[model samples]
Target: MKCVAQAGLYEARIPTGAPYKLRIGWADGWEEGADPYSFPPLLSHHDLHLFAEGKHRELAHMMGAQTMTIDGVAGVRFAVWAPNAKSVSVVGDFNLWNARRHPMRLRHDGGIWELFIPNVMSGSRYKYDITGPDGARLPLHADPFALASEIPPATASVVASPLDFEWHDEEWMARRSSFHAENAPLSIYECHVGSWRRPDKDGTRILTWDELKETLIPYVVDLGFTHIELMPIMAHPFDGSWGYQPLGLFAPMPRQGNPQQLASFIDACHQAGLGVILDWVPAHFPNDLHGMARFDGTCLFEHQDPREGLHPDWHTLIYNVGRNEVRGFLIASALMWLTQYHVDGLRVDAVASMLYRDYSRPHNGWLPNYYGGRENLESVEFLRELNHAVAEYAPTALMIAEESTAWPGVTRSVDSGGLGFTYKWNMGWMHDTLSYISRDPLWRRYHHDNILFGLHYAFSEKFVLPLSHDEVVHGKGSLLSRMPGEGGTRYAGLRAYLAFMWGHPGKKLLFMGAELAQWEEWDPHGELAWNMLDTPWGRGMHALVRDLNRLHRTEPTLHQRDTHSDGFAWIIGNDTENSVFAWLRYGDDGKPVLVVCNMTPVPRIDYRIGVPLPGWWAERLNTDADDYGGGGTGNAGGRSTEQIVSHGYEQSCVLYLPPLSVLYLQHEGGAG
Candidate 1:
């Protein structure tokens, strides 16, 4: 029991046995002076309400919810405010995987089930077994109030209460202000923790966050990615659903690690000079009863009606953002992660669903916004408020949207007729690129417009070129699979496409395995076929991606904020033949970079390519280089710029462009 005073505020500590009111300085800097001891309980409560009227929205939401207590034992002493359910048992790991052995006692006040299982240690797992009104046996259920973790069915998980890890990220944490101000180019490497690493043999061995920190951190840093956009780490009840069906918004999945372990992983990333952006799913949650569906005797946090509550395609329950308490709960949850875990950014998942009331639904099943559109007014308001609060509280943190619709002003400031996000995924680019690449090499000419068409929207809200987790999953296959040919040609084609991706106007993001040209669909159970790293093709692709990262960092033309009309220009060639496509990228200093790509499978003969300047241009990078598993059809190392010439048309030049290869030419400023 000690006391001290600082900045006109009195701080006092009391023994654990005493019942005392802990007072802190109010937001208005009010002091509890003089007769603080003589204040009556009722009068003090009234005064507290006066103090709370404008400043305690987050605390107010917490007050209406059921109270929970964690006994000193390693496990939690949970008692939901639910006044229903005929029977309930703490049925997780503490009960030896039996649902019936440890039934909870029904308290007198309501139908609340109470239980304290001492054996349910921290890092030990458990769930509830609730028997409903008509004798329906609900198996071990996810906890609505869980601040830690949940398990996927058919695969049991343990509860890891937080860990205490040593962190060395104080410097990164302090630089938050400058980090956001400069608008540094955000090159994100999006990854799914589960699928990113699993047992090589696959007998249900999961790689923990600790393992990822040790194994994946160095690889990512070596790859030169500035950030890692983690696919949802929030606790969920299904392995097949990815982390999108979130059951615990405030807690990292225990299946991966304890909260502290997850924090350590993030800290490790920061130490390696990488930002972490979490994929946050706020659109809907799983319908599992043990989750937020029907706790506290009703659909407390979700919409009551099916039309408003259900996401038909996802088969999940939508949150009622219209309710003040629910809105506060969600906003508070977002703030909690930012504050507690020090996450640098959040990629709001499925934002298109949240924006439209009729998203994936029939006309009669939807509501309209104030403008008489399918836009959900409440959701819009919630998002606006969320962004505003994020800016106010965590100004350094970036908010990105996985929004596909042309939801006007999504990345604009909320007060300036916009949604106030830092960036929005260039979903159009992803679709167009995939569609174009999936076709045969000969047919690429017909679809060539898709690539340029994507550039028209490149200026839309600070875009990020995302070949994200979505592309590899759901039967789309890996990037290598989407290429036109087989063997070394396919590998070369993939390298060409990746080079194009890196040199594009926007920020870049690739899934974990894409750097290595992972042949199979991504699996959540094991490490990226690490064994493939020894192969020549895999190593070549990996090296190319690493070099691309270096190129992005070293070249100012590839940065985000430098986009201008003159910064990029496409050089027209034989459009009908679709034989070649060329473009120039210029930095602010007028240093030009010429890029020419031939989509044809056969070697292009005497292909005349028009460059922007007549000066001698050196081939900086070529996909046809022997080092990248190409046909060695390009200039051998230093012989690239030997007497290259130009005609008119913006200082145009001609060259023999190679087939299925991309060439980068940098102006060397003299006839060789």
Candidate 2:
């Protein structure tokens, strides 16, 4: 007994199905059962080698608390990486939250500590009790790889079952390759899950995953949005951060129900012919104590240097991208969502912040990379490796970047020395267009270049023109409120802006509530004013958006040549005198859709515009039409092009240009 106590080792077998107590210390004895140390190593040497090299893209299966039934002892195998910890233990309700009850054994390969507790069934809450390098008591941390977490107001990680679901999305998975952005109609609806819909006004309860399946899927399908981009579904401590400050990178928040329920929601989306995109944040994480901050009582997940690690704008901690394990961890989390949850894509948030070392900082406040350059070399390499890993793991899954900079090759292939993203959010266009439209129409002609400047570099990258949640929140006001005019003029201007955006030369993305022309700035904690649909402006605005989405999808000329510069050309490039702009969007087959926007409040009569073909031009959509609660100043049904040439086109049309309206016209019965 003395030798066993002194050695702190058990060479012989302790009988199973009994509580084994270590009574060597002055404190109360440990009533730990079935020595987890006695079990063989969970990970192989090769696996550890790869993890250290930052190549372990499938760590989701290895690093987290995995449900296993080894030798008929059904329980969870908890594993965590804290290389500098003096000692680590798995503490939970099973052991009365006593850290000494189940001390985990340190792994030899990569500083991973692991312990398997028998009969620790699913739904049991647990956390890691880590001792720091200097032997200080570190705060217990929530599991970084937990598949599900306790509902907010609690910070424990739940023991989740192996993520297995009887998925009925075989058809979607099989045909996903065809849905890539380059060849498909990509219109995304950016949504915040909790704020998307609520039954009550006080914001007490959020819609569950099951409830969302019944509501969100059908709504998106009806609106003809190809994909619904959810703002981070990962488990976060604060609801107001909107899942941006995540603690459990692998776990879906329990507030929405279990992991399987979220899976079922995704399955329902696929069944209803809607793809789902998750807004993934790998840029920075909140500095919550129970989170990645000061992990293992050291700056493990983040950089030790504040200039390099802390985000100036968000007050969060930036990931230490130079660390190989961190890269592996980040990539693995991304792949887990794509592979396990069957998510169609990931829109990587705050990529511009990640790319630059001196982002939002007074130049000297930040550090330079190896070459003394402002570009973060480590972050660049990490992003490249992440994109490579995602491509290899989930070939059809998209990697989008919300990068606001003019950084070249953002959507270009890695082989060509670019970031290799599938699509990029056009922040430049969003900001410029919004600024231009906010000007009074009387002064719009003088600032006409603001509206036309985007086309100069429109095809620079695969861009998703976004009027996202960022535009509507934080006192930026709603889309309806952003217009320069008031009353009916504002409504007409907003509808025109939307139509123009839909016809613009990029993939489309619109935030929720914008379709209803919501006048109030978005409130994360309150339900949207859905009852506004009863009002005239609201009903008309809602109907206009539905028609716009339908028109955007059905018109081949709008998207077929979107990636090419030749697809767009100016028909009336210099007619800024009356605050008017005309352009043509062309299909690859040479068919064209002509667009004319009138930004002023006064209607123009006998306005002559050029058309590609001399035929009956149908009025496909008019933002000022009575259908959209406008003054309805537009050509009745159609306009016939005159034989007289104008603006160097083969023919011209004299029509009524409605005030604060944009018109989409298609040549009826005209061939290329």
Candidate 3:
């Protein structure tokens, strides 16, 4: 196998005693040992350096040189990676989608399809016309590069840019930095910005960042959520995706606002004392022709085969991480959000898919690991490097993974055989809790183990009890919709469930309308049925939710950071009667705050539950409080010094238990 050395190639010498023959080129040729030409064509050392420099400059141009000065007007230099296309053109407000008027030049050196349109500055509407092989004309889309607006597919798109806003977030950014430094407990209010607010009437309304600053920020602050986890604000072409199919990683969705508007939104959240964490989807991208697909005359960033590049379940294109340029682009995107956007953190989406080669497995299409195993080692290495870069570039920015697999130590430090994510979504708890709550009351007892099972691995890599967007979408129904029993019983059960959620071990997250108990599943197009707030039931649920947030924040025992091994004590777990679950959250000073929840519908006359400590206790918060829209069976706020009675072999406290209620008991001086 003999071939002249070519640019962009590398060679290695074989050992003299090596017994292996050399195979080169496309497997059509072979040679005996010590054959110099047997080695693959190698790029000259100088050419390789030039190639590396060119690649670096290309990336720097995209990231650093924000406004590409052209014709005395600063516009962006747009580029897309599309190798399969024969020709590509830029069309937008300037060219009106005309292909011939704005044909992009091809850079054969890097195989990049590029165009530098003069006078087409930020806020210029655009799409691409990509002519694929066989004369198939496809409209190339917005480069995920610094785009300001997107049509959100199935909706009209307009021209917008990042330079169109007044931001006020310096103070907030400083405060957020301090908060992260202290490792403060984060309670995230995950929301979709568009659907978070809409016009009172129905003719297509979008809430400006100012509008959300005026309305949503105060509400979240009052609700006591320490952080706001926004659904992907990165520009995407589909509204139905809930912002998952990102077409532009650098630009916030134009429908919401320009880059400045988004900055203002984050600034507003910071001013309101809330940290912002973006939900980032690097797992796959939309296969919109107007986007990444073959924009550069090749499958430059993605795998060539549909089987290798496409996400079967999501119908999207997956990036080829093995490509150094592609990997650097993604890493750069992550850093861009942290450094430029000043985002407090990121929740990496669909990481399980990214970490696996045969994620949604097919019929023997994927390659095996080097050791003939069914693992994707390349993917794992990519994740490890990603985490390392994130930590190095943005120490304060938390990196969370939405990894549902049993991949061990996902949240552990990179040096410790882990992916080094700050936290991973506790999918186990979410599944168990949702399943248990959806069952009938009689059967609810049978599923009592659900809560306890979650606790078993509760401390495994810091977990977040995520009642996320997934639960509200895909026909899963709203949180309230999942409750069992009828009318008041159902309401009480829902209330008890919330109380239990907040009282559990791990941080908590509630999607957009869950705080108000919106009965309908999430609708991406409109507000959260604010009219529901006018109803008595709605008002009651709203107040209860608000109070829950207040309770979670005000009580040191309820704060996730405070309720660790020092504070957590499981007093009772009885599987026989399918009733009686009790746990205690204590203060740093060892003062106990007990929680006893009975899932039964009937009042228990003399329920005996063992107490972790022997002492007087006071009712702090109860789901059955009259103000909370529950029956008046709650004990008034005061201390109780009852003597401990014997139940079986354990010393216990017997109290009249309310059906479908959570009782919180704290030692007299335990309040923190």
- List per-candidate RMSD values in Å: 10.2, 2.9, 12.0
lDDT of 2 by residue, 350-422 (tens): 9999999999999689998888899998888888888888888898998899999999898888888988899
TM-score per model over all chains: 0.80, 0.95, 0.83
Query: In candidate 2, residue 325 scores what lDDT?
Result: 90
Query: For all candidates, what are the clash counts?
Result: 10, 0, 17
Q: For model 1, how does the per-residue alpha-carbon lDDT over 1-672 read when each residue is reduced to its tens digit?
A: 244545333446556555444333556764432221222111124323422231223332232112223232233444433446777666665445666555566653333455544334565555666666666765456555455653555323344444355778999989866655423566788888776766565647777888988887887889888888888888787867888898777667767767787888889888888889999988999877557776544676688888789999999999988876567667767876776678999999999999888999998987677688887989898899899988888888989899998889998889898988888888988899788877888787787777778877677567778898888877878889888787887887888888888777777889889888788877665557676688888888888888888877777666734334556776754364755677778776566777777777777665555555556777778887767667677754322332344433544454666667788878767543
Assess each prediction's global lDDT (C-alpha) against the native: 0.70, 0.86, 0.70
10 residues in a row with least lDDT, candidate 2: 17-26
Cα lDDT for residue 336, candidate 1:
65
| CA displacement after TM-score superposition, residue 125 of candidate 3 (Å) | 3.6
Error of 2 at 264 (Å): 0.6
Which whole-number lDDT from 0 to 100 does residue 300 have in model 1? 61
TM-score, cand. 2 vs. native: 0.95
Candidate 2 residue 388 C-alpha distance from true site, Å: 1.2
Write the candidate numbers in order of decreasing TM-score. Answer: 2, 3, 1
